[model samples]
Target: MSDVKRIATRESYGKALVELGKLHENLVVLDADLAGATKTAMFQKEFPERHIDCGIAEGNMIGVAAGLATTGKVPFASSFAMFAAGRAFEQVRNSVGYPKLNVKIGATHAGISVGEDGATHQCNEDIALMRTIPGMVVINPSDDVEAKAAVKAAYEHEGPVYLRFGRLAVPVINDNPEYKFELGKGIVLREGTDVTIIATGLEVSESLEAAKKLEADGISAKVINIHTIKPLDEKLVIESAKETGKVVTVEEHSVIGGLGSAVCDVLSENYPVKVLKIGVNDVFGESGPALELIKKYELDADSIYKKVKAFVS
Candidate 1:
């Protein structure tokens, strides 16, 4: 147990990239014209020659990043998830993903948390798209510590990867910098037997809060953080479901083929637990505050508590 703090996932990327850049000169950063906003500017300041600002054209940026990867350079292309996954999808699929290049696509402002930016900026389907790509690894880190750990892990992992994160500050759950983080492994934050709430990204913090709130109401909730979405920790998920009997999956992304879907895909085959999903219900988010958007889409802790309560009762 550690003191809770508030921080954005994007800041973690900037901080982590700078540290990695210092250690490895091959760690190059590319931005689709949004260095300042996406925080790639930090890397730009540290490694000017290694930072490439490929203005606005996300497709061309992907092509260039893939080329850099071919030359034994690790390129982390920074942009909003919307443009990275939507606009340059074809380029990402053809060049980077198809070849399984050693490139890290760090897309910030993901999900509905890109507040007041509306649907065009907030991307809720990036995970589904990136996870579907063959040989592509999709990761959505829970907090600043996990985000930094993910950056380091992505650098070591050889192939095309997608790291989705948000601009808004959420609660910092992991305090120990020494906490072991492995790819495709789930972290059990809290243990219980009544039900299991599997969550990822910002939803992980919400799930922890929901678990605490549920405990006050006499419900024992199991909270697990699924940081890796593509190669999901099916063993942990299935084992948790077997213990809980019922489960609830939550994420800032859509319920369709995201966290919830991935959990269901695992449980249905082995454990077979009743799952209630909490996420953006397959619709675009409108312009509003990030908290308001999360509330509207039922992606908060209260919503998760309510949904799990219903499933249990």
Candidate 2:
């Protein structure tokens, strides 16, 4: 894992914006005075005129993005997940979501991976909040490749889009030529019949590793990477659930209303199955190293392996 190429999804968000800016003249970026931390500074460096600094006012930044969208500009409102989704909830919901504007929210520094920033900055509820919006499309990319692809997809797709990115540098898992990204589609990383492990964001890699460990213990664990939470790939999830009978959801979010809850919603309605959710167990994250916090919250590969093994047994 150490030798694997690693890049933070936040960095990919910035670089992808640069690429998109070159192609789309109507593309505009707005930031809440944290361009450097959010990595939107890369876009500002290249297209200073096109990038708007809203100066720490996330709600106002969202409003500005909404206005830009109405004028035929593809506006990407950039900020940390805490500020973008949490602080600017009302503006995002009413101004962008209710109107169904073409506003793309590039929310970086999501989940417990935010490290020393503590629970206040580590937004584990962004996906849940975004999911509730009527027309908002929620996307949580797994890695650099997926993050870049998701950014481009958000621009191509019309309507309000909430893209969650992480500060932690994760291994590039989808670098293969055969890898193709589609909105509202889940990628099956590894197939098995015992139990299905549905994961999103940075948890996808950890879930895959856990599957490998589960295999050694004679358990056949299927791994599915679900990038899009809202408008979830219900077909794939149902099919996997039917085959495996048991399910486990992994996410770098709270077990309350994030990916786990979304998965539960689908399964409970269509196919009833026992699901063990692996995530932040209804607790606030304290200040700590990002990696250590992940382990403490039982979101790391080893913890996932142990939890899944016990559940299966």
Candidate 3:
């Protein structure tokens, strides 16, 4: 992981969109006037003809994406998570999700990692909103590699998809040359019998670091990366829960309706194991440095280690 380069998942999504644009002529990219910040500017620069800046109108952009989908074009709608998932909720729900249109919503700047932008710009409920839409695929990638692969997967999949990306640069933990990104599959990064740590997004890398610290304390911890949120890999979650007997879920989103709640739902019905969810306690994030905010919210490596230690006891 240390040898690998650090890059934001949003950056990876931008580069992937550009590469995918080269492969598919019908691939259209749309942004709500934040391409440079969301990194969709990368695609606009390469294919200005196909890239549409729908100004600041996120709702209108979603409708346009759905209309384009009806015409057999794969439209990737881009915007900040708050506006894309919040302001455009009605449009996305009816136009794209309800009709099962072949539109992909690339929601950037999701979660608290949006940093100094404060609570209004930070979107902590995007996952919950997308999960409610029937047949919508929700993917939150763990690293640059996964982000790129998830974007391609969303393009190939025939239906509405919500792809979440972060603003903060995260360490690459899935540098295993053999690592492959599947749509609904969860990968167990570390094998341990004591406790299992289920995490997604930036917390995936932080959880890995926490696992190392737990290992030193003679508390072996298994780390699982769940890049796909909606169509969760129930088999991996249940099997890991059964093996470890205890589970700890970590994420940068709210504990209410994000990865932690999703994991608990799976375990409670199938394996019935205890799960400790470490996330924002249904509270808004404040303006601060991204890394410092992560630590303040207790979403960092040390916080995970401490929480899991208390849980396993």
lDDT of the candidates, in the order given: 0.91, 0.95, 0.93
Q: What would the C-alpha RMSD of candidate 1 be, to one decimal place? A: 1.5
Task: Write candidate 3's Cα lDDT for 199-223 as tens digits.
Answer: 9999999999999999999999999
Query: Measured by TM-score, how close is model 3 to the native structure?
Result: 0.98
Residue by residue across 173-204, what tens digits does model 2's lDDT show?
99999999999999999999999999999999
Tell me, by TM-score, which candidate is best.
2
Q: What lDDT does candidate 2 reach at residue 135?
A: 87
Candidate 1: tens digits of C-alpha lDDT, residues 92-152:
9999988888889999999999999998898999998998899888999999989999999
Q: Model 3 residue 157 lDDT? A: 95
lDDT ranking, best first? 2, 3, 1
Model 2 residue runs over 4 Å out of place are: none
lDDT of model 1, residue 96: 92
